[model samples]
Target: MTDAQDLDIPTEPLPASVLTGFLGSGKTTLLRHLLSHPEMDETAVVINEFGEIGLDHHLVAEATEDMVLMNAGCLCCTIRGDLVETLRSLYRRRITREIPPFRRLVIETTGLADPAPILQTLMSDPLLVERFRLDGVITTVDAANGEVTLDAQIESVKQAAMADRLLLTKCDLVDQDRIDALTQRLAQLNPAAPILQVENGKTEPSSLFGCGLYDPASKSLDVQRWLKAEAYEHDEGHGHEHHHDVNRHDERVRSFCVTYDVPLDWDRLNAWVDMLITLYGQQILRIKGILCIAGEEKPLVIHAVQHVFHPPVELPSWPDDDHRSRIVFIVRDLPESLFQETIRSFNEE
Candidate 1:
């Protein structure tokens, strides 16, 4: 059992992770393997259609009309209505003892769906926000056909870029050279996210869960682990020439890290972030960082999906000795120099 098991009976807000990937990327297969684990028994899964997953093999008992208790003790539910309503209903049932009191949640999105909308939906809803906090996004990428998928569908590229954890699935079907190439590409696409090679969707639940800024078991902010800004420091920003020439649309997408050596002014930082998102919310895919505020001794952690920013939280103390602020951004057609200049101006003010 891992730290995720400590959350079996959530004392505070439960963490919810969004599982997204392209068609045939093995999301369902990964999810099925996760549910089969005894440690994942306390988790609840929400999907669009029950028929699509074919979970009858793991069926244990029916909890209600739309929800079922799985053989390993997870509660599986189909969306009764809109996502907001479905999540609300699940919360209600959990409190009322209508279903198992699952401590964590995993929402599976459709292959072609843009995950930003789903993240925004959860953030906009006050009730959902109070009951659940985003753990992180777990995206599955097929090693066999990931390159083709990314070339053909812009949505697949977004899915890979916005992920907090990238699961490289079907690696057994591809050669080392292909896997190596795809791995390098994924790193450039999302340097902050950790890529885990998964064969036949076989992966431990521990590796996929608890990827957010706050680690429940540690009871503190894990800034370095969450940010992984070091990845960007190592990136030389090369190799996009061939990709850019082939797929102009994906070439516009950029992932980079911006840093400030001095402590950031709270007021100015807020204004800068507000203006950036207000002007280019649709273009921005994900934003996350740990800040060293001017007046605050402890570091502040922030995360956002598109225009919706999670309320910034302050840690009791710094995660480590390093105190410089680092912010990572995944955006489309947004110039890095623009971000650097804007923030630089705000800092000067």
Candidate 2:
């Protein structure tokens, strides 16, 4: 293990990301490549089990203790009891000079696991909030079978819709036509997330990391990059409200971005959001926004997964000249027109 004293301990909470995918989606392969990358050298990984990830052979010839330091300087460990406990233990070990001073963390969930609970745990657990902030969710999709999987498995649809970055793996095994179809479907399921094609887990760490509002590499908040609201510009004029296919799992989902030119009253906005969550929390898969509050000069950022919202953060200044509020929503069976109409009704009231 790299000596803790030699590394720079993070002054702020470490950014943690969740890596999830359906069975045979190549999460382990992608993680293996990430662990070996030079850019991920200072990263620590928590997996459900060592046997599940099958990373033993790839690890360096180091002692197989609770945490193993890879040749590229990455630290790998299996979950201890539960996720919250494992993360707390990792932070404790890091501060006490027991393990390498890893700057970031990645948690790998089981193939069959629901990502919402994991995200909820990260957002709601006070201890985790104090030590680590959620970076984003990275999901892998198998190019050959993604369509079939999405049709049959609701969990796979959730994994895709909730991803901040979607990786299309095993592309070489399929034709471009299949890849194109899957890409279009994923875009429909989640417009804001960028879909990247991964060839046998060989991808740049930059593409997968820094997905959250904070850019660890630049040590600054990257609201524009995190939001990617432009992705929804293409979504406009597309009648997502009219499309309905209850048979297909992804057909029930809709993703869109809304912008408000007027500054919003904080209290009214809060009330509206509370009402929205209270009534449709389960259908609302993810919500992210950069708001222009009525009395605030700086932009306010809000993030939510299901019903759990992160504490609002105000930037020192707006990211750009545009002062309009932009909000992105990835929801299931929620009519886009109805959602926009609700906002209109609230604004009028």
Q: What TM-score, computed on C-alpha atoms, does each candidate reach? A: 0.87, 0.87
Name the lDDT value of residue 199 in candidate 1.
Answer: 82
Look at candidate 2 and tell me the lDDT of residue 45.
80
Worst 10 residues of 2 by lDDT: 68-77
**lDDT value, residue 265 of candidate 1:** 94
Question: What stretches of model 2 exceed 4 Å from their correct place?
Answer: 1-9, 49-81, 216-219, 233-238, 241-246
Per-residue C-alpha lDDT of model 2 across residues 4-91, encoded as one tens digit per residue: 6754456788888988988889987888888788988778887653343454334422332234322221112233226677678788
Q: Which stretches of candidate 1 lie over 4 Å from their true place?
A: 1-10, 49-81, 234-244
Q: List the residue pairs that clash in candidate 1.
A: none
TM-score of 2: 0.87
For residues 171-255, write the lDDT of model 1, one tens digit per residue: 8898999999888888878888889999888899988888888866677775555587777764366633434444535677788
